[model samples]
Target: MSALPGLDDCVHCGLCLPVCPTYAIDRRESQNPRGRIAALRAIEEGRSAPTPGLLRGLDDCLVCRACESACPSGISMEGLMMEHRSRTSDARSDGRTVAERWFLRAVVSSPGVLDRFLGVARLGRSLLPAALLPDTPGPSRLRPARAASPPAATSRLSTETKGRAVLLRGCIADRVQDRETRLAARLLSHFGFEVSISAPGCCGALQRHSGLVDLARELSLERARDLLSGEPDAIVVDSAGCGSALHEPLSDAPELHAVAERGTDTPSLLATIGLPPPPHPIPGPVVFAPPCHQSHGTRSTEATRSLLEHITEGEVVLLPGEEQCCGAAGTYFLRRPAKSRQLGERAKERWERGGRVKTLATGNPGCLLRWESLLRREPGVEVAHPVTLAARAYGLESEER
Candidate 1:
């Protein structure tokens, strides 16, 4: 039995338990960070193969990385999880479904195919079963065709300009959250920076989390080649999950390492450029739900919070348990419906208890879709990306151009 790298870093500390969403909800040993590591260690020691129970324990994890943020030993929980998943054959079967695999391979990799499939889904939604369709608003409501155009570049600087940035329009994000991408581009333009939307492709984050490391590597290299072709000051990501994935160092692809080093999230990018005063005051209270990837993965909680508070009309109220996963840890809700619902409902209840808010802003697309699905019954509440709200406040036009 060979020892796994980073497996011994855990000192059996229980500090990660309280912050782990699965452990907090299920109170099971295998659901927490330490337990999972211990289970991996057992496998490393040749005590157990990748049994169904072991795979289930690993699959149930959200991989939110909150445990890493809370760990005193600085264990890279995210890397450990990804490494274990990649090494275990049964892990892939446990993490993703057939439909998910097909979508990731066929649709996510090709923008034209995804757009056509979304068009068909939109048209046939009424005839299809409720479970088959997206619980949040339809594609038409989320992304208008005209909204896909890049925002008019504001900077006089050429493509070689110092402040020029590229926006990663990820596969699903490109199709579902097109408005957020557009808004982010416009917001960056408003700050006097040239923004270019990257080519349509998966950031490979989903594939990596699903244990398809080879596929993830291919996608990552493809993205790196495309994005690096146009040397920009920064590569900005609107989705927190994609941003976190992009930040990961790819040893096999040294060019990808450079790209990751230059990657930045939308909130952090906006904050770094200095948020301009809102052109008009927002009418009602604004609540922020920091996505787990942003809060824990990128450690940008303060940056996102400060940006929202600075631009919102009044005090920006952070949703209680902002550190906890929203259960939408990149399709975790789809795979484990019950546990996902439990966590999402818990978050919804927290927001409900905080009174009514006109708008609820979050950093990741998964978080946005999950919150929208949970709060669909509630009227007069809007779920949006923080950059969308900032774009609105700046009076930047988001209509189809």
Candidate 2:
């Protein structure tokens, strides 16, 4: 046997039953942790090699970390899944034209370069004919819900607040919704945090998941040291994927303890600060579509919904199972647009079953972009970050303060 780490962690107590999105979607044992563990065990025993079928079971997983959250034995499904991805078959496209390879490499390595590229992409989007835009380019740069000014600097923090935090302004999130990052900063400061953007670039989660394990570790160690050098208490990350990746331990660099101690998701941090929920309840009826990563991986759904409920008077409507993935699956939407769209459409229909949906709240930018693309044809549907809705309801500025 290959002796996979944590292989014996699964007690098979079925504690993760409710949190498995694939299992929820299909109601099959094969799609849940139990089956996944079996598959891994088989591979370890050389009973079944890492064939396409085995890869599909692993790949189809949203890696939301929900299973681990529900595991009573403290089983680390997320870690296992990441290890599997890191060792899996190379799934990249065969004919990566020079431009494609260069673009991916450049963006993964350098945040400044990616931001510049996004700026050009946005300019092209503005200038090109609507029909000419690729069906699904990378990610969107447009801010959702079209709101007000976001926070500007540390000066916005009151003199009473003395602690400093490093805000890991994500490459993808910054490109799509810089406003969201600003709002996050403002909220952090409002809770007595002095926030600063210290790191120079992307977290490389996307590249790492796309079979660039070495590159991911390199980027992780580099960024870890850069942010750690500032000696901040914590690193506030608005992007779920990036934050999750940041929280992960880097085996390659044992000395980088800063990244391990300080990294936390925006919602979790907000909840940690004991920020009271909004005084006013949301007025309209809405569906809270927790991102797969946030709900499953980070398990921040309660904090997210609790925070939203405090801000608006709207009635929060959760789906039947509540743990099912919305299907965006990060870049999976781009790689498997057809399957992604199918999943998104289904989620939308569920959200709008009896009547109209005033809003759909999600934690990840990718989910927001996916919802926008899926419902672009359907008028009156609005997808926004939970914090954006909270900010609007509380009369907080959308732009930098």
Candidate 3:
């Protein structure tokens, strides 16, 4: 009981209950944060075993941390959930758990394997529509293989140069988000920053979100060390989930914690140093889905809005139920496709109301993919990262680096 976060601090005020998606679905006490914490306490205190019912209750949680925003006691629900999962998750208990574990530990976390895996997915998408497949992550993004380096473009600044920065190319993102990664690099370079791509790697977000803490810790430490090796002034990750995960205290290792502190999202870092007024305006109205990680975890919504407002001509509308999870809670959709779709239906509802909007921008890759999957039938609507939109507005894709 003492080992779990928020166990001792919980006031049981039930502020988190209404925001919990699983609880909303089940309406069971077992599905909410307070109930989950009680289960953790019972298990830790040896008053109850981690039985299938209790474990299932915990497993059903999205870990989206939607509840954290409502907590008055300042409880770290994600921290408690991750720690609980780290100790209790049993891979051998069932085949589903085993497969999910294998995919994250063996496939999604390995850059080479992830690329090949996505290669197979891209092949699959070539045969049929990716929208028919719930698990394939934004198949449209896997463009023909190209050079990873940013084009050598001239900077507008002559004397006021920004310091060097690194862009983390994530595990699955190495393939799926390659263009966004390149666009981000191109934009950062165009913005007067000397940017370098972090070597292909996993930030352990998928793993950590799934409760595989030890491996997440190891992977985070390694990636953090690698990101820091170049001595860059900033490590800008365009992926919200990855940026938020970078700050996760996956391990108690001081070095890992130190390296984690330097990671920031493109908008947050860009907002700090500022940018030249965007020469081109994003066409038409834009609808934005701020990722739960950004809104609830890092609290970078203002910075994200500041950067969005810089490049757009029209209103950047927030999706309805902005507090809700997209159900892409790292590979959660893969495990529970129907429930994931249920969770993501809110975005679709808002998309229907967002008439005349061509671009649906989001900060996180998962949310982008989620929106892509949810709104695929509306081919006219383009789903993109905010940085991708910013990069396009700057015409960086056409300019030579």
Local distance difference test values of all predictions, in order: 0.76, 0.66, 0.78
Q: What are the runs in model 3 whose C-alpha is more than 4 Å off?
A: 129-132, 143-151, 154-159, 353-356
Compute each candidate's TM-score over C-alphas.
0.90, 0.80, 0.92
Q: Which residue pairs does candidate 3 place in steric collision?
A: 151-401, 152-401, 153-401
Pick by TM-score: which candidate is best? 3
* Candidate 2 residue spans exceeding 4 A from truth: 8-19, 23-32, 89-106, 116-159, 252-256, 266-282, 398-401
- Give the per-residue lDDT digits (tens) of candidate 2, residues 133-179: 53444335542222223246533324566477777655677657666
Tens digits of per-residue lDDT, candidate 3, 1-401, equal: 37776788888899998888887767889989899888888888889988889988888888888898998988887788777877767634677777899899888777767777778877888788654766565556664444455445545543566888888887766666777777777777776788888778888888887788888888888888888888888888777788888876666887667666777877877787767777787875787788888888777888877778788887888776677787888878877777777887755776676563678888777787788777777768888888887887787756532
| Cα-based RMSD of candidate 1 | 3.0
Q: Rank the candidates by lDDT, best first.
A: 3, 1, 2
Candidate with more favorable, higher lDDT: 1 or 3: 3
Judged by lDDT, which candidate is best? Answer: 3
Q: Looking at model 2, report the run of 10 residues with the lowest lDDT sum.
A: 142-151
Model 1: residue 167 alpha-carbon error in angstroms: 0.9
Better of 2 and 3 by lDDT: 3
Looking at model 1, residue 266 earns an lDDT score of 73
- Positional deviation of residue 69's Cα in model 1 after best superposition, in angstroms: 0.6
